[model samples]
Target: MCLNLKKGAIFVADSHFSEVNVEFLSFLEKLKKKEIETSQLFLMGDMFDFISGESRYFVKINQKLIDIINELSHNIEIIYLEGNHDYNLQKLFPKLKVYKRESQPIFAKYENKTIALAHGDIYTPKGYDIYCKIIRNSALLIFLNFIDFNYWLSKKIYNKLIKKSICSKMKDFDSFAKKRLSYYNSDIVVEGHFHQGKHYEEKNKLYVNIPSLCCNKKYTIFDGKFITTQL
Candidate 1:
């Protein structure tokens, strides 16, 4: 039976570009086939590896993304949570949906339950790191964006650091998940960034740390009445 999200569902952020295709494609196709697009698509952050106005490939790629949105816009709703990577996209794609952090704290209620969702970068114990913070700051991002060579170099370093962060220099997402859950007192805590796809019942509470759209598949399925699974 097809299950629609009665009170809406959320897809936590982070795109990481190429990582999106392989794993999540099958699941997205499944969601399409299931006629279950009632869930809202919330992109928490880093929707791109880098946004390059000068790169023809980057422009084409974003256009394809826009096409994907147009195709799914009706069946599903979309909201893009502003991330450090998406800063440049505003110039090229001004109309894309974006949210201000102070204005965030979007809600999704299901089966008389509610949860707050975000990229969860600020909440991470080591959250965003020193370099990440510097680059994400408005002034530096603007300066780097205006310079093609600088943007390219910055992209290379950013990818390299992100890889390192994902691999070695990190604490377990479960601990982070639990910590965030403590602040909620709600039914669930949905976060993305650690790229760790996990969710379950513990201590009478639900903690969900969504996996990245990069490489391995990750998505949370919420039927109108219940959460089908976290895949």
Candidate 2:
């Protein structure tokens, strides 16, 4: 979908994979070359793997990574749409702009597209409140981050496990999105949380299933022209 953006056009994302993949980081660098700092970055959910144990907000990215962001702070506005894993968003550091919401519809006239940015966790028929509690304090998350977090292999494995767990479609939230889209009838609905990367479209509608790609395979981007990229 071509939502032609203004220079204010930015990047939207979810489940930031982290500094594990060389290829992905290279991709980010390429975008950075275009000026990542000056652009805005919207995170749909799961920006990091801090859903657990010891702290209110745990960061997988350490000093070096924080340093990288400090460098880009001047040029970008980083916003985060809270996901099940990252419920206590207000606790997230200043760098992450966490929106305490279930979902929201955004209008990008400059890009000529209407975007529904949700972390995709609401799909659970039961509810996110329950899931959030259990997932938030896993010993594994704590142990892993304490040791060698961000190792590509471990992250890949983690992603695989998360996928397997979402085997059943959470119709409640899914239908919620569909209904909302009908209400807004936006040009596109881009979402993440399922960790599945794909796109769906109708005559006047589009639904984007964003993958939980780490910082490397990160999927959304925008230029002065439009908001377009592969998930």
Candidate 3:
């Protein structure tokens, strides 16, 4: 679902928060304490390394962070764009505005310029789309939860994810941006996944690849133009 973009909006992407790296939790605390102020909080994607609404086991493991976000939602308008690592969050965050992968690239307006926001995996290969569909299906999640009686499956997946390196530099990113921008119809396209933390313009469209807070503690703030900074 698309919503209006308010000025002074904060955009955080790819935190990939896990038990070992809890900086994302600390950031949430800052927001809760009013240490950070914003009209809206945009969780671009991968906020959690792995979280599924169907599994209570995964939810319990990250309960503290969940609690903080739920509390913050009472006051702040949070728009969560579900990433590859996190999906099926309707039950996890009932109050917050959640958008799944299939319903992404939502439209908004920033200073009279049209904006398209997504988790940045939409334009991937066909195999990726099929994989996403299978993993994001509520029925599949329920089946997985049923088989993970002792949470062994969840533990194994989490362990593998924690060991994988999620930060890196991509080559020919400008060419990639040009291709991706063609799929969107907007003045500005904002997304998080590549962890590129850069901005580019193709034709009349602007593309903002938001940095991962877990990797560099960087985020984007919109004034007249999107500006990246470490918080």
Candidate 4:
């Protein structure tokens, strides 16, 4: 059986929360305070600048947002698709459904149409695939955690991440979308990695590259069709 995609569900992608980009923190605050409401929440990832379950230092620094998300999960359904910047999160978020990259393009049924969801990192080159595997390896993360004792190594990495620019427009996005569609057979293809907030029809199939909350200050609401709303 396919998952049910609920109406009024909210989809957030690539917030990239860090010391510099705190828009996601405010968004979470609104959710916690009931300023915004949704029965289903889809976190289409890169939700953090960097994070992993085995990295104690990163987890500790991000504990506040983590606590709020854990609390919210009890009252709502949350589906998180792990992106490159964030993975190994099953232990961190036991209440939510977390899909790792290896298990992506998860299918759901929405209004009799098939919907596919991913973090937009698949169909990548072999080198990137190998890098993703190595980065998410538990042993390597544990070793990094050991080096991050006293927040030394982790702090440097965090500083660099926050300074890096992530917002940019893609060239030839129309062709890019068409090429990407060649890999999927679903009625709707939804992803968030390019940081491009765009939706268009190709071969009668809906393609939605969800907006980056950090870049666009927007998120998407799905009733029958996708609607992008500003913060």
Specify the highest-TM-score model's number.
Answer: 4
Residues 1-231 of candidate 4 have per-residue lDDT tens digits of 368999999999999999888988999999999999999999999999989998888898899998999999999899999999999999999999999999998999987799989999999999999999999999999987777768889889899998899999998888888877778989999999999999868778988999999999999999788999987
Please give each candidate's TM-score: 0.65, 0.58, 0.96, 0.98
For candidate 3, which ten residues in a row score worst on lDDT? Answer: 1-10
Candidate 1 has its poorest 10 consecutive residues by lDDT at 1-10
Which is superior by lDDT, 2 or 4?
A: 4
Predicted candidate 3 versus true structure: per-residue lDDT over 165-200, tens digit per residue:
988888888997887789998898999998999889
Q: Candidate 3 at 139: error in angstroms?
A: 1.8
Model 1: residue 209 alpha-carbon error in angstroms: 1.2
TM-score of 1: 0.65
Quick one: best lDDT, which candidate?
4
lDDT of 1: 0.54
Residue-by-residue lDDT tens digits, candidate 2, 129-163? 57555555547455655665446545564566444
RMSD of each: 5.6, 7.1, 1.3, 0.9
Model 1 steric clash pairs:
13-44
Which pairs, if any, clash in model 4?
none
